[model samples]
Structures are given as structure tokens and as C-alpha cells.
Target: MYAVIKTGGKQYRVIAGQKLKIEQIAADIGQQITLNEVLAVGSGEGLVVGTPLVSGASVVAKVVSQGRHDKVRIFKMRRRKHYQKRQGHRQNYTEIQVETVNA
Candidate 1:
């Protein structure tokens, strides 16, 4: 089965054995975490969507790693003003593997 869950102010569609990187969470490597904010659960053509969150529905995941994404460079310049600015940023993320979707 697959599930739609919310975390870190984002929503993700996930399935068992799938690995994805999400906003950094306070979890250790190899730790199992249950995501209780399940929005929907589905298999084949049968789908159950919750009003806000599915009661008792959850997604189980194992933390694989924590890391940062590639740096994003930002540059701004004003023509005829001789003004320029440059900046870069990297976003932290946590990698997790979906283990199960319980509904």
C-alpha cells in the first residue's frame, strides 16, 4: 500500500521500500519512526482520504542518513550602479526508507 503523509510542512506520497530525503528530523540512523499525520492511504483503486488526517493511519520509516543538499548560488547585480551581491545556501535533509503503511 501507499500513503500520503505530512511532515516538516510538506506532503509526500510514499510506499514501502521507497527512500526519500525530507526536511531534517531529529532521528538517529537506523531508528524507526512512525509518521502519524497520514492524509490518505490507497492500494489499486481503493483510496481513503481523511478530512484532515486519517485516524490511526500511519507510515513507518527507518532513518538512513542525515545530510545537506547541494548549495544554491544566488547573485544580484544592478546595472550602471556598480552594485553586486552573491550568496549561497544548502538545505539540511534526512533520508528515510519507508517500511510500511498501516491503515
Candidate 2:
């Protein structure tokens, strides 16, 4: 079975035993977290979509690691004014292993 879940303003399609990196969550490594915002669940036969979220449905996951992604460079310049700016950012993320989708 597979599930569609929302986290950090993004949606992800996931299945049991899948590992995915998502926006940072305040949980320690090795901790188990339940992703309660399940939008849909699907099996071999059909799919069930929720209005917002499916009641009594959840995806259980284990926090595998927490880290930042590669830096993203930003640069801006104005031709006449000779104004320039540069910046770099690394977005934090959490890696989790999906354990089960209970629906």
C-alpha cells in the first residue's frame, strides 16, 4: 500500500520502508513519528482520498537522520547602480523511514 502525506507545506507519496527527506521536524534521531496528515491511501485495487485528512488513518515513520541540504547560492546585481549582493543558504531537513500506513 501507499499513502499521500503532507508535511512542511509539501505533499509526498510514500510507501512502507521508503526513506524520504522532508522539511525539518523537531524530533530526535531514532524517534518514531506519526504523520497524521494523510491525504490519501491506495492499495492494489483502488484509492481513497480524504477531504482534508482521513480520520483514523496515519503513516508511522522513524527518524533516520537530521541534516542540512547542499547550499544554494543567490546573487543579485544592478547594472547602472553597481549594486551587488550574494547569499547562500542550506535548508534543514529530516530523513525518515516509513514503517507503516495504517488506514
TM-score computed on alpha carbons, candidate 2: 0.97
Q: Rate the local accuracy (lDDT) of all candidates.
A: 0.97, 0.97
Clash count for candidate 1 is 0
Q: For candidate 1, what is the TM-score?
A: 0.97
Q: Report how far off residue 101 is in candidate 1 (Å).
A: 0.3
Clashes of each: 0, 0
Clashing pairs in 2: none
Q: List runs of model 2 lying over 4 Å from the truth.
A: none
Q: Report the Cα lDDT for residue 82, model 2.
A: 82
Tens digit per residue, CA lDDT, model 1, 33-85: 99999999999999999999999999999999999999999999999999999
TM-score list, all predictions:
0.97, 0.97
